[model samples]
Target chain A: MPLSEFDIIARYFAQATPGRDDVVLGIGDDAAVIDPPAGQQLAVVIDTLVAGVHFPLETDPYDIGWKALAVNLSDLAAMGAEPAWLTLALTLEQSDEQWLAGFSRGLSELAGQYGLQLVGGDTTRGSLTVTVQVAGYLPPGQALTRQGAAPGEEIWVSGTLGDAALGLRLVQGGLEAGDSAAEQLCGRLNRPQPRLSLGIALRGMASSCIDISDGLLADLGHVCAAADCGAALQYADLPLSSAARDLIAADSGLGDLPLIGGDDYELCFTAPADRHTDIQVLAGQLDCPLTRIGRIEVEPGIRCLEQDGSPRSVTGQGYRHFNESS
Target chain B: MPLSEFDIIARYFAQATPGRDDVVLGIGDDAAVIDPPAGQQLAVVIDTLVAGVHFPLETDPYDIGWKALAVNLSDLAAMGAEPAWLTLALTLEQSDEQWLAGFSRGLSELAGQYGLQLVGGDTTRGSLTVTVQVAGYLPPGQALTRQGAAPGEEIWVSGTLGDAALGLRLVQGGLEAGDSAAEQLCGRLNRPQPRLSLGIALRGMASSCIDISDGLLADLGHVCAAADCGAALQYADLPLSSAARDLIAADSGLGDLPLIGGDDYELCFTAPADRHTDIQVLAGQLDCPLTRIGRIEVEPGIRCLEQDGSPRSVTGQGYRHFNESS
Candidate 1:
């Protein structure tokens, strides 16, 4: 017997309710009901991942599901909000029970980890696409935004960058890596950890923040635009994973990928220079490195400089979703 | 210059946000910030419409945009909530400036009418697909749910049924109609009016309620399942538009189309028989017709009755998103 839409939702998507006190009504209704905490504003965002666009069509269903929710969580992390609820809209060409099982596992696992309740969503038949809208809450006036950076503030980035971009290259056969290193690179490309804890920790410390989804420069540009300032970065100071460093050593051409590679899912933030020790303590407490690689400048455009006080020449632009070649 | 994602959003999706006091922050951010009113719970839902699946691929982009948000409003109305914020995730195969302009106009018109603030969303490159997630607010304990119907309550529906289904048939050339009637029917199909006002009127009075997207019988089945009761409907009592009645009068076989046809976008509810006069007054106040077509029964399955007390059999099931033959 063919699985109906209802059957698909019940069998795979109807996860065990996490006993959320705020979710008054969850799945199985026309809409979910949530009683948000007092004095906390809701932060919401929606993102769509289409096959052959966000990820390779041949990517594992589990990885696709993980990445879909992970990216949305990253947005919430950027805003310094604790994830409270999420809704998924999944479009599939056909029903594959095994694929559904794997996908559901990946989604449920991440949702469980963060205490996010999968409150409501839709399942439809079409070309494969996954759209996730997440809701998080932060105390009124406490939520971080990309519009608060001031001149002379230090810019910090959580976690190493560019591993995911390299992972994509390795998986697509555009680049090659050794065995264990290949596993780590491909995993980075397939599964990114949202810096929720880091975001929460930097709530009052960081003046402005954003997630690195469209590479470092592009996302940081958003911060600059919102904050009405410019940024200057020491290109050599960008934190890089050993895997990415080795890849760049073998091919100097790959050195610029971290600057323009997308899907990093790490928080790029600006904080006062006096709070440098506080950020260092946060990094130690969370076991996540927070590196200061730049500073907000008075100018109007982003500038990349070498260690020797010389400008570095970069090639290509950041990822644009609408560009025909993307 | 190729349109960047940010450029597309600013030009098309960054609508003049309705002055919603609850929307602390709206478009152009990583996520939107909203503060639901105190003493109210949030009703949230997400829906997706794919090209050639939910609607014809040739349908106008304007109509597609309107219908995408309209259908989500229908869900919110069914919950007796007032819409507050919405986020859209649109994926397209390519960027067409003309199409985007028309779509944004249609979206802005409807959003402006309902005071729905377009908070934040994402636009990506892929096969045409539109996903909208809406958030509304209702009193914490006054939500009209599908589980509140009593066994002896009267079942009611709002507006006319089956017109959109007939419209689909006419448009697809499966059925024929006059030009004026065709235009009327097609308008009903493409531009469904979500019964927001009537839904608010029915809040305290309605025992159970749902929007009729998947035909009367199919949607009523959901009510029955949730209420733990059966339903008995007099087939001849279903409110039908003049165009639909005339079409059915020509061919008796087409009579069942209204019974199981989908995309009505009308409300189906159950209330006490004593509230009949109250509902009548509500219909007058809201300027929407209320038709009492059936009653909740103690049995386990839905039954259809002819005027002469004979059993009527439905020919086909309502539209299911995943049904291969639908």
Candidate 2:
């Protein structure tokens, strides 16, 4: 017999994470009641992932669950918020017990790491889709936003760029797979980490911050647009993994991926030049790579310069779902 | 020349509701930040509506927007929470300007009534789907849950039952349409008013409550299961609109609808027998019809008795998304 909706929830989703004191009521209720701390404000974000749109349909369910939650956490992380509670609205084509089990495991493992409780959500039968909403806590008047960058501020990014986009190519058979580097890139595509710790550490140090879900140039374009500033990027300063460098070296056309590819899930932030030393020390303590990629400029457009200071024209404006060609 | 993702958000969704002081940041950011009051606990709920499954594919976009938010608010209402914030995840096959305009209007009008500010969400390209998550405030320790009903408590339901189910039939062409009664039923199906005021008023009085989304018998079954009790309903006492009554009189086979039909979005609750007079007064104040349909029992199952005291067997258990047949 096929599992009913209630059975699926009870067996796979009801106990996804341990109970938290702030969660007065968790799963198995019409709505979850939560007690937010008195002094802290809440940061809420929602994101949807559709099969064959956000990811390939053949992607593992485990990776789907992990990536779904990770993307929303990335948004909260950009705001320097502490992870709190989550609600999931899952629409599946059918109730496959194995798929549900894998997805549950992936979601619960990450949720347990952050002390996040799965509060309440709806599970329905439809085309495969996952929508996750996360609410986190932020100190009053201290939220990091995109509108705080200033001219001459140093732009910094954590982790390598373009790996996830490269990973997607490998997953889609556009690139040759089976190599160790290929596997690593594919892993990056499947499970991009949310930079929560770095976001929290840079609370007072960084002037503005955003997660690089829509490529370096495009997401930074958003920050620049919001701050009413521009940015100048040193091409050599952009961080790249050895695999990405190798691929780009083999075919220079692939060099644009580091600038135009989406789904990196790394932080792109700007801060005063004098804070550079402090950011380096913080990066060492956190054991996360931090690269100084560019600087905010008074001009009102993004520029990428070569080592000789010549400009390179970039064409793509990152990924948009409803563009004319798409 | 099609609208891009960002354009769609900025034009149709960014300013769907008036700005509120609690919303520190609204749209056009990585996430939204909100400030909750000191003395209140937050109640959170999420629901999803998929085209061709939850509603007909040709249904009006305005009703789709209204209902997506309404169902989630209904859950909060069931918990006696005051509506506060909402996040929507909309998945569309294409970006249609006319559809977007209608959806925004319907969403904004309802949100204005409740002072609900749209915080943040994602707009993605995929099959047509709408997922809404709502956060509301509840006085500390004052939320109504399904576990509070005791034996011998009277079960009462607000407004008419089975109207939305009949409305669905009319919309689906299962029943003849175009009459005033059919139009009224269709309207009931599309726009379910979440009983927020009534729910708030019942906070101190009702022992247990649930919104009737999945039929009267099935929802009462949930309350009974949670409270570890049973219910006995009087068949003659079930409230019905004139249209529904006339339809049932014409065909006895449709009699089970009021008992087992779903999507009523009305509150079914249990309270102490002593509070009957107070509840009647509340009904008069709210101008919403209230019906005393049943009583909680010491037994472990639900029963429906005719006026002469004969029991009627109920075989349906309301709607479940992933049942064997579904």
Candidate 3:
């Protein structure tokens, strides 16, 4: 017998959301009710991933599920908020029980990692698409926004960049990577991590922050625009995984891969020059590398500088949805 | 110039959401920040409407936008929550300016009517799909759930049933409707009014409540299942618009239309018999009709009764997403 919508939700989606006191109701209701902590502002974000557009058509179901929630959690991480609840609107071509079980398990693992409870959403028949809306809480006036960067502030990024983009290229047969490196980079591409703890640590210290979903240059451009300032990034300072560096070494023409490639899900932020030491200590505390790559400037446009401080020419700023074909 | 994703959002989606004190942050952020009213639990719901699945492939962009948000708000209304904020994840095959403008206008009108502020969302390239997640607030312990009905309680529905279903049929050429009536029913089908006020009023008064999205019998069956009881609906008491009556009068086989028809977006609720007059007064105040069509029974399944006190045969249950083909 084919699994009905209710049967699918019950057999696959519904599970014990133990020890969540703030959740008054979870799944199996018209809406989920939650009592958000008092005096804390709720941070809400929704993101949609479509097959063959947001991801490749042949991607594994588990990886697809993980990436879907990971991207939304990245948004909350950028805001320096603590994730609490999530709702998923999943549209599928059909109900494949084995695929659903893997997808749900992937989603459940991430939900457990973040202490996020699956609340309520809809499941319908359609071309494969997954939409996730996540909610988090932050103390009043404590959120990190894109508008706080100022001239003379130092730009910093957590972890490495360009690996996911390189992974994508390798997977698409545009580049060749060694077996072990390819696996690592593909992991980065398929399962980008959300820097939740790093974001929380940077809440009071960092002046501005954003997740790098649209590559380093383009996302940093957003911060620059929101802050009404310009930025100068040292090309050599971009953090890159060994695999990404090897790819660029093999082809110098791919120098702009890290700058223009997206889907890294790493946090790019700005902090006052005086907080550099504090950031170093915090990075050690979080066991994550924090690299200084750029600085905000009074000039009104973003520029990338070469070894001699000469401007580098780039064709694309980032991945533009309208310009790209699925 | 072609519309980039950001340009489309700025031109069509970014509008002033004024005087919303609870909304700490609106659009143009990683996520929206809101300070939900104190002491109130947040009720959240998400629904996805896919092109060609939820509506005809050629549905007007404006109507598509309206119905997407309307269905989500209807879920919130069923929970007796005051609408607060919404985020839309819109997927489109391509960025069409005229279509986007009309869709935004439709979404904006409904949002304004319900005081729902557009927060943050994502725009992606895909087959047309709109997923909206809405949040509302209700006093703790005051929400109406599907599990509260008891035997001897009365089943009531707000507004006429089957109009939208009829409208769909007329538009699909399944049946013909008169010009004026066709327009009215089509309007009902495309622009459903979420009973926000009625839901709020029934918060503490009603024993159980659910929005009739899947048809009267189907949704009431949900109430029955949740409350662990059965329902006896009087076939003669089913409310139908004049157009629906005319269609049934022409073909008695269409008599089951009202019972099995979906997309009404009306509230099907159960309340104690003593509160019947109160509900009537409330309906009068809201300028919407409240029809008592059935009573809760101790039996374990639903049964439809004819005017002559005999059981009526029902050929269809309701709209099941898995069972139906687009």
Clashing pairs in 3: none
Best to worst by TM-score, what's the order? Answer: 2, 1, 3
Residue A287 in model 1: shift from native, Å? 0.9
lDDT per model vs. reference:
0.89, 0.91, 0.90
lDDT value, residue B235 of candidate 3: 93
Docking class of 1: medium
Best by lDDT: 2
Least lDDT summed over 10 consecutive residues: which range in candidate 3 chain B?
Answer: B12-21
Residue-wise C-alpha lDDT for candidate 2, range A1-326, written one tens digit per residue: 77887898899989988789999999887899999999999999999999999999999999999999999999988999999999999999988999999999989888888999999889998999999999999999889999899999999999999999999988888886449889889888998889999989989999999999989999999999999989999988899999998988887878889998999999999999999999999999999999999999999999999899999877676887989495
Candidate 3 CAPRI category: medium
List the candidate 2 regions with Cα displacement exceeding 4 Å: A324-326, B324-326
Across B132-207, the per-residue lDDT of candidate 2 in tens digits comes to 9999999999999988989999999999998888888888777764498898888888888999999999999999
> lDDT tens string, model 1, A1-326?
66789888999987733658999998987888899998788999999999998999999898988999999999999999999889999999887888899888888888889988899899988889999999999888888888999999999999898999999999889999898888988888888999999988888989999999999999999899988899999999999999999999999999988888999999999999999999999999999999999999999889999999898888876788777465
Interface RMSD of each: 1.7, 1.1, 2.4
User: On a 0 to 1 TM-score scale, where does candidate 2 land against the true structure?
Assistant: 0.99
User: Residue B134 of candidate 1: its Cα lDDT?
Assistant: 93
